[model samples]
Target: MCDQCISTVAASAGSRRRRLWDLPHQCHCPLVGVCFPLSTLRQLVNKALGGKAMADDYEVHVGAVSECLQRNRLSELLQKDLESRYASTVQAFRAAKTTKELAGLWADAVRRGDVAGAFWAALTHPRCDEVLQEVVLRDMHMLQHQAGAAIRVDIGKFNLLLREHGVLARELGKAQQRCTQLLAEKSAEIEQLNSQLVQQRAATIGKETRIAFLLQDLQQLRASLPDYENTSRLRKQLEQLAHRQAELETQNAQLRQQLGQAQRALSLRGPEDAPALASEPQQDPIKEAPITLHLGKKTVLCVGGRNGNLAHYREVIERAGGQFAHHDGGLENHQGALDAVLGAADLVICQTGCISHNAYWRVKDFCKRHGKQCVFVENPSTSSLSRSLQQIAQVP
Candidate 1:
């Protein structure tokens, strides 16, 4: 029940009083004609009719009477009732600040059917808009106070941090001053040490210069001394040494030739002539071939070499039953030329020196991809070239 309900009840009561007085004579029989006052009638109706239907009927009757009543008077009565109810509600809400007490009041008002009590209950309850607004305002004020306290605490912390930083800066300045003083002291000491070092180095340099001059003087004195007798004696001794050196050289050459001949004879006998050759062969002059090799025709790819070496290699290849092709150009274009020649060649021989790693890698890759036999050869001397040609001719 609220102020509006109470006002409505009052209006209904007045209307019912008027209705009772104005009843028609035909319907005024003792059983049908009720003469109770408006208050008593409402009580009886409430007792007899319970639940939502009865409440709805009571509301509708009150609304009809209110609509029919004089507007000004009804409004005055409603305003007075609302004011009184509101004052009582404000006092109750103030008294019962906590949500639990407000909730208890709400249950009591609903049971007792008190309109003002119900309004106060709603005003004080937690879920109600009016109560929620007041609660939010209080919480906001509390938060603002807490924020002020936190700000103060933060300010204190910041001040402490600044003080510490100032102290640290002071300490660092003192340390820097100490370091600068020490550096000045060390610089003076270093200057003294540098002066001493310079003196020592100068003394050492003077001694070395004196020693050099003395050595030069000694050398000149030795050079200026009469040396014809010593030279004649030394020349005689040198002649004797020369004769011994020539004898030793001749013996070394004969030994080397003997070793080479032994190696060649052993190679010619294969592996089974060890026990039979108890006596050594007599020394003889080395025989020479009747004719030298000639390069008439052949095809060969000459990769990396000096110009003179390349010409000699071309000649040797022609002698060895192969034609000669040459690539002499920039490092960048060499791989392409080598690849073309390798693809057309019967055999690939890479001159190991003077070729770049990129060229070697490309040539090896080409040979591997084409399943061609690739040989790496050192540059041949004239005799080695002849031997290589003979070996090539013997290849099946």
Candidate 2:
């Protein structure tokens, strides 16, 4: 027995010693000389021998026995407590101080069928508790670090996306500005084109109006103009007729005056001279011709006489007591003829149709330069020739 066992036995023996004083047997041993009931003696021996041996050599032996008895008593008490307070005892074991103590409690709870106490004992061991706490803390820190890294990565990606969007927006703005500039340029071009079209249309309308006016004037001129040859010939014939009529009138007037003078002379003469004039029947007044008076001769020259009709036209001039001359040639020869006629003739007539435009112009220019009368004649037929002869006789 140990000190705990000895102390328990000694307490029981002391209570019983007061009830029984004398022993029934006596022993020769000095350590234990008295003997009584076997149960009582054994109790007394346990009390006296426990922890009383204080030798250094017996110290371990004594501690062993005391520990054995204490464990036996603890096992019995725990068995009874486990049925009622098993949960509380398990919780208390979780707060145990050492790995050994926790293991012992766990074994006791298992033998007594305390399931909760066994679980707590396993988890609350000193080494297991430290390792579990370290593992849990390490995992939590890893998770926090991973979460922070993920957040940083997301932020970086968001910034990149924002930068790209900004670039795109700038490009889009530039494109829009270019489009606006192009549209403005196109609008200006369109306006210029429209203005040009308006100017062109106005010019076309003005041209059309001028053409219409010219056409109307041309139509009026065509409606009024006689044939060129006929007009020229008629003008010439009228001039000739007027000249012949004037000559006839002058002759008639002279004749009338002469008759009156002769009658006066016959009356003034004596009776004998009157009888002599009566023998001639008064000079036969009806049959007598009037005296013709001579005047200074006038000459007219005709140029460009291709048909050689100038001789026939001379009859009209001779009746008027005037002379006529002509020069026949091409334009160059005609120009020389014009110069000669200008020097010799009082009047010059140039036929125009036989010449080109340049020759006609030259002839007209020559006449104007010399201050000569020039008559232009186109084609002449027999009727036109007769009319031209009449006009020449009647020329003023």
- Candidate with top lDDT is 1
Model 2: per-residue Cα lDDT at residue 213: 100
Give the distance in Å from residue 170's predicted Cα in candidate 1 to where it truly belongs: 55
RMSD to native, candidate 1: 26.8
lDDT of 2 by residue, 131-232 (tens): 332332343345446668998999999999999999999999999999999999999999999999999999999999999999999888867874543455
Score every model by TM-score: 0.25, 0.23
Q: In model 1, what lDDT does residue 293 have?
A: 33
Q: Give the alpha-carbon lDDT of every model.
A: 0.53, 0.51
lDDT of 1 at 323: 82
Whole-model lDDT, model 1: 0.53
* Pairs of residues clashing in candidate 2: 2-66, 236-391, 237-387, 239-391, 239-394, 240-390, 240-391, 240-394, 243-394
